[model samples]
Target: MQQLSWLPTHPDLSGAIGQAKRIEDPLQRLHEAVKLAAHQRDFTLTARLDKLAAAGIEQHAAAARLTPLRVALLSSHTVDHLLPAIRVAGLQRRLALSLHVAPYGMYRQALLADDPALNAFAPQLVVLALDAHDAPLQLPLQASQAEVDAAVAERVDELRLLWRRARERYAAQVVQQTLVPVAPPLFGSYEALVPASPRAVIERLNAAIRAAAREDGVLLLDLAWQAAAYGDGLAEPVRWHQAKQLVSPTLAPLYGEHLARIAAATAGLSRKCLVLDLDNTLWGGVIGDDGIDGIQLGQGSPS
Candidate 1:
């Protein structure tokens, strides 16, 4: 299933865009367009906004309130497909992002080696997106809890070191993407009790990661929990087996949105503010027409 384009562009978006384009000031026109696009989650909308926002930023970045942010994505899997969505999502929050993607499978090496190119970029935020299959822990299916505990500790310890390096080496905020638990249950309901089971170890690693992240003041992408929330929409087994794309191309846009939200928070530009209309929302009917006494209020009205 195509997750990215799950829904077509809204039928009314074109009319809305036409109205926005009619505005005399370019920045104001772009502002209105962004306001409309920010509330939508569609591939077509993202693509258009990606281009439009880029040009708008180039012309009136400061006036448009486009906050410039430098981001680095160090991943063990393919992530190029997700960039457009990330940029568009940033624009939604009025952030103008500049990104650096580490060489494939070279996430650790780049940071460890202090690659010249990466150092040149000097990213303000670093995202570590390691895949579960890439973890070095190798436990027998029947291995003991002690063995599982040691492996989980070692993996998270290495991650802690990496997080520390990111902060000390570059003064960058770190966002660790939790290892996705893609392994199928080996013993059905009994799997949780078996630490050596592939799924169990991943879960253990995720828990350890969260604890360490909290202690180290590192932010978490928490893919393990995201997968639980996204269900089958997070990824497909076929894509993983065939192309090593840990994230499904169909859901790449949503994935980008998730990452962008983290970036926004780090920049203090997170989407926390909300505006709402009161009609039929805080009450059962329009407050203006019905008035306070006439509107539904905990059995106070029509009773």
Candidate 2:
């Protein structure tokens, strides 16, 4: 285990990752990797450790009991940060996930063109995490509503072409994320004043994307709703400007959970029950000693 950041905050993370890496048993290694992945806030390190464990699983595939899910990740921005999140989600869902990341900014080429390398790395699922900047609908501050609408229509056609080519050439299901609205819009507060602003254009583009995904049988991941679930921290303007990050680093765990649930559902591996610990969870204190009156379980009390 290599320690790089605050140890007090992530005491067991490094150790767990190391232990998982050294373990010979594939299932045990993956279990430990999942725990380690959930604890670390450093996404880059998380991706490294998760990939290490996945490599081991591949090497020992004959002995591994769970079927491995070969997934290709296609994104417009720096998404090495999301690799571990997806792996952790797969672990939680009892699906072994092996990620193959397409070259940065080459998703269109990988999808539309008959790339031999992409075809050879045949995946079971292809995840496309797109952004407003990746699409053609991003308009200048002075653009009119007519221009924005026209651009949106063209973007939809581009998406359709990409999806059509992917399905025809690859044996994989497309999992695409709808475009997230651009923050700190070029038009500022007035951006929402009319339907022609950058914000409105992105919103309309997202809706069109969702509708197209539904009609085409693509697995849609609602990143917009996921951002809302994580609140304002999910989409900080500074992070976007600095690293082109779609969301805050702290929200990775929740993101992993959502992705895991979606993958589990798609694979028909839904959990029967969600186990939760007691004590601080079910009540304020131990249920044994705390009488019925001592326990705080009412409409007002959170317990």
Candidate 2 lDDT over 53-85, as tens digits, reads 675566554454545777787888666766676
Which pairs, if any, clash in model 2? none
RMSD of 1: 5.2
lDDT of 2 at 5: 30
What is the alpha-carbon lDDT for the whole of candidate 2? Answer: 0.70
Worst 10 residues of 2 by lDDT: 1-10
Model 2 lDDT, residue 107, Cα: 92
Candidate 1 structure quality by residue, lDDT tens digits, 205-260: 88999999999999998888878656664556788777778886567678877888
Off by over 4 Å in 2: 1-27, 31-52, 136-147, 185-190, 232-237, 272-303
* Runs with alpha carbons beyond 4 Å of true place in candidate 1: 1-11, 14-33, 271-303
**Which number leads on lDDT?**
1
What is the overall TM-score of model 2 with all chains considered together?
A: 0.73
Displacement of residue 47 (Cα, Å) in model 2 is 4.8
